[model samples]
Target chain A: MKQLTFDVAVIGGGPAGLAAALAAKEQGATRVLIIERNLELGGILQQCIHHGFGLHRFKQELTGPEYAQRFIDMVCRTDIEVMLETMVLEITNQKQIYAINQTQGMMQIDAKAIILAMGCRERTRGALRIPGTRPAGVFTAGAAQRFVNIDGYIPGKRAVILGSGDIGLIMARRFTLEGAEVKAVVEILPYAAGLTRNVVQCLDDYGIPLILQSTITCIHGKERIEGVTIAQVDQDWNPIAGTERDISCDTLLLSVGLIPENELSSQVGIQLDPVTNGPAVDSNLMTSIPGIFACGNVLHVHDLVDFVSQEAETAGCAAAAWASEKQYSSTRIIASTGKPGPCCPTSDSIPFDGVANECCATWGSTQIIIKPGNNIRYVVPQRICPDKKTTLYLRVRKPDQDVSINVGELKRMKHTFIRPSEMIKINLTPELLARHQSDYLDIHVVKEMVHHD
Target chain B: MIKTVICTVCPLSCEVELTISATNEIEKIMHNRCPRGKSYATTEHIAPRRTLTTTVHIEGAIHSMLPVRTYEPIPKELLHQVMQETANINVTSPIKMGDIIVRDILGTGVNLIATRSM
Candidate 1:
């Protein structure tokens, strides 16, 4: 193995890696190398043929490739080095990275700082534990997307997507536009986990029906996917006795969820957040190992690529600072103490022991509990420390109107808005916490408005 | 005639109503959420452009053809004409995604390029 050196080694060439490399250069890093597993530098953005990205960041509705090209062009004008078709095999505690490239064979990189921007991977059928025979027509939504958009091969004429995630929704439209019939988008959860705009623009506008609280119970086919059995699920997600229905289709696409690409991060001894299935980092986005950092979907699942770019910018600058030997002590571990509750940013199976002295000090008990309220899907920061400013994100539990969220002491933030598919963000400060001293935080939402005035 | 248009330039995609006088004089506009929407509606009600993505034959490659799209917005009505013109052309493979194939093919100053490799 040949040894290479750089000031920064970005592990993924997606939006996060591109932004990180560019930001690191702007922050005065001398040498930067970006390693990408794909043949291109855009990451998954390459397969995203839709035109809903870069609205906030670029102020234009650019397709995934267009949005990615803007950054790729900027990186080209810089001194950054991009290595495509390069896969990082291992990352060591000492910031040593081992990678393989067809041309280079085995290569080693030793950098002052490492950025884990590998992004996330789609969770497939095996991970979902779906009882079915392995069929050729079954594909993850991303894989199907690549087949239709990039590879120029139509997966099938009739399709059924099993999850209402953004990718699944976008693919529904893509498949439809490509002349394939999308039968339905079946989601196990009562609400969609994608963006509100996606549900409306990609599905509703295109006339793709969404079945809520439903799941594919079994797959039927021998040589290929011939049909699927869908059943209406109960509150506990168990299929109701007689609600099973069969839909004939040639293909099945899964958009269940995404798992952070943190195998290398974990191999390097970085603490993992089981909830986000990403690396555990502090406010600065630095991982457990000093001088190493992570951002983007690798840190947590992000609904928007613009947010991924912003997070990567922070990680890049922080990496530059760390390379300069800027040091800070994390004497206290503000962990989520107590039984790993359902919303503890960890395992959902863990039982809740409620508030305890050992609860992550970040919670501090004076904190407000931001759980999934009525018609609200899920809220982040299951427990928030009012002492420190925190931005909480929540998804609507269902399609709602005139929805108003009344935070204990704060005036109701209301308007006709919000969808189960979209996540809403609200920032809470210490000043607001001082006024509300309730032991258990209460959140009530009501729909009374027709539209936003 | 009064025209209502949806500005698909951004995610906001505001729906705007434009009132036009018989003499072609610009009149009042309502329901536009932002300044961008107002300008977009004004331009769209008169002329509309759309981005196009289609495939053309590619020779000397692993596959028969590669997907290509316009680099910028093209006149909506001319989409069929542009498609017909490119339909006969064959691009040689080893083409990178975003590599410009025809410079300003439609005279809209927008280049047509391969969207994905063969």
Candidate 2:
């Protein structure tokens, strides 16, 4: 058994963790540690060898490995410590981490602040519950990608992808380029689950058919995947009778969705947003359990790695601040002048009550709640501290053109189009926060219809 | 002549319509949101290019295969040929990132460089 302490401890050494650790070190965190389960620092990016990454951050189209290398190089130059092949079994609410590794049998890490960057995992065939026999040829799109790109082995000669996700679309092209036939990409939704560019460059460019409003009803195979039975779904998502058709294929790749890795967060009693499937945090990316921050896919599944880096930087800087004893006192205002209403008395001084106190004691700043109204799926940083500007990332329930995103009269921004696949970002400055009239900030989308003769 | 191209410059994926003269020169572009979209439409209409990313066989490395991609996008028409050429190639381990695996692929003057170190 070994014991250690750090100014900041970051879980998961993927893009998010890598960015966070670097930012924390740069922010003057004396001792920062990154724990990675993988043998290498780069996570899924190692297997994601395709281009189209780093467009926003670097202004150049780069492969996932290249994008990751840039950060890995920067991390190499810093004094940040990384624990590779270390699995964090649990994290306590007090910022204590219990982990295990082959080199270090058992270890306990006590940190002043923690950053959760566990990233996410792909949804599998078992999760989808597709009626089928246990087969060897079945694989998730990511698994197939790893097999082909990293291991130099083709999963199958012919394939049928279950979801039109970005990975599935990219895999479809990869298979085709490797001399395999991609039969079809069947998506349950009418619209694609991936970026529009993926639909065009991966499927449309290759002449692959994208079947919408359809799903695989059954998978037929005993030893290996022989084929699949796909069917069109009605408005209610029930398979319509007589619309079922069997397509012969050697492989079935599931690209349904991704779930954030938050078992540790749940175990630590961190409140999670049901919609985002991640911990609900405040403006500083601090989770319900103060001093514990979260970012990247573990916060919410993002379409771009560039956004993940941006978010991780925020968490890293905040964690460093907490560790350096500079915590958020600067942003906290007097309770009397707090927007919405006067702050309630501190919970520690008063008797335990049913209502939770929403005010911070150090500066008496009231926490304002943010709620999604209509068409908007959910908003991150579910709560905001009005002292500084905060960025809210959200997703729409449906696609629309000529629409305005209204934040309860506090802020409004017009967009040419908004889609569920693309996450929207809105910045609420301190000036906008000053006009807050309610405890709850409502965000809704209002679409303007266009007419053509 | 008119060609409709979906700009892959960004996720916006604007559908840009390119009007070309009979002499194969781009005359006008419409419906693009940004300058990059206009350039993408023109280049894609005239001579589409795509960066080819794939794995190549590696010996004595952490992994059996190493990911590689062309330093620059080659001609779209040369993708299949270049892929075929790259398929039969193998490299030894101890390779560094940015190491060129294949030079002047398909006479496109684009070199296939290693994206990872092994």
Candidate 3:
């Protein structure tokens, strides 16, 4: 068995892993390596041929490949080693990585720190439990994207999209441009799950109808997709009687949602968050197991790639500091401030002056757990240290106007509107943290009452 | 006449209302949160444009198609016509990012550039 050693070992070389490895190197970590399971380095970005990425970080509207190329090129220019076409078989809490490739048969890599950036996978038809025949035309929106954009084969001449997420809306236009007719984009929710810009540019501009509060009830096909039975649903989401209609189409694409790939994380007994389906982490992005960190879609499904990169950089910097034994044993403080568009932004620099081992020992005893309350769905970085600034990323359970978000008794902020599809960022400053007397922060959202004359 | 437009500047999605006169002039705008929203609604109502992004046929590359986009937004109505013109482009690989595939496509004065190298 050939054994290799690195200061930081990154798993899955997607947008997350790429940014993680680069940040690790730039943070003065020696011997940083990226382990990619795919034959190429770009990952899913290769098939994402649409524009409107990189609006943040780079402040430019770049296509997915172009956004990925910026990091790939930077990684190439550095000493960051890359292992393509290699799959990680197992990972141990002791920081031992067991992986295999055609060239290197059963190799074991030892790392001082490990960063998980495996990303997420699209929800399939089977997950939706759509009662239908196992047909060839049924595919996820991402799979259809790969076939049309990368593989150069349009999935079908006429297609029906089952969700109104960002991917579904993009594919509606893609199918239309490829000389195909998109019958309709049926969404079970009353509002679109994607961004407003996408809804306007992808569907409205194409003259494609987005039917809300309706869902696909059944499939009418044996070998190929013949059509789908659609029905309007009630507030309880159950199909309304006599509201069923059928639309004939050759393809059906499910753009339901995404789930973080956490098989390896759970295999090592890392604590998982039931809401995010990812490892529960603290301010340093470190999982339950010390010296092991998680970021990107593997941490939580992100709406944009720029935020994934920003988050991976945080995990990378933390892993590097952990590998070099530069920070407090298990209580490294990461300071973040302000609101991110849809994700939390890790601060550029936080002076660690006087962060002694003795100082950090008492900080862990002062750690506070963040609890989701009221209309709050979940908040990331489930725990926070009171001595430093921590940016909390959270989502609401429903849509409302004049919403007031409160973080225990320490802080409160008001927003004009808050929706389930959008994540809210709130920064916990040191000033606000000092007022926290409770052992846990119960963060909740409440709609303010309106007054009339 | 009054028309309402959804501002796509950000996720807020403010509904901007525009008052138009008989000769098709915007007389007044209301309900926009930011200056960008007013501009977005004005352009959307009068002369709308969209950045054209699509794939073209390529030979001797890792893939059979190359992703390309107009360097700037082209006229909204000219999108389908311009897409038809780009279909005639037959280029070889060994191209780099920002490489131009078609110059002034369909006389829109917007060049079609490659999104990434094959």
Candidate closest to the true structure, highest TM-score? 2
Q: In model 1, where do residues sit more than 4 Å from their true spots?
A: A326-416, A423-453, B1-32, B35-67, B70-89, B93-118
**Per-residue lDDT over A33-116 for candidate 2, one digit per residue giving the tens place of the 0 to 100 score:** 999998898889999999998998999888999999999999999989999999999999879999999988999999989999
Q: Per-residue alpha-carbon lDDT of model 3 for A1-453, expressed as tens digits?
A: 989999999999999999999999999998999999987787788778888778777876788888888889999999999999999999998899999999988989999899999989999988889986777899999999988888788989999999988899999989998889999999999998887778888899898999999999999888898999999999999989899999999999889999999999999988788789988877768787777889988998878787788788888988888898645343444312111122222322122111221222323434566778999988888776667677788888888888799999877788877878777878878788888776567999877776645
- Candidate ranking under DockQ, highest first, comes to 2, 3, 1
lDDT of each: 0.75, 0.87, 0.84
Residue A100 accuracy (lDDT) in model 2: 98
Task: Arrange candidates by lDDT, descending.
Answer: 2, 3, 1
DockQ, Cα level, model 3:
0.64
lDDT-better candidate, 1 vs 3: 3
**Docking level of model 1:** incorrect
Expressed between 0 and 1, the share of native interface contacts present in candidate 1 is 0.07
lDDT of 1 at A103: 96
Sort order, TM-score high to low: 2, 3, 1
For candidate 2, give fnat to 2 decimals.
0.85
Put down candidate 2 lDDT per residue, B16-92, tens digits, no spaces. 99888999899999989999999888779878998899989999998888999999988888888888998999999
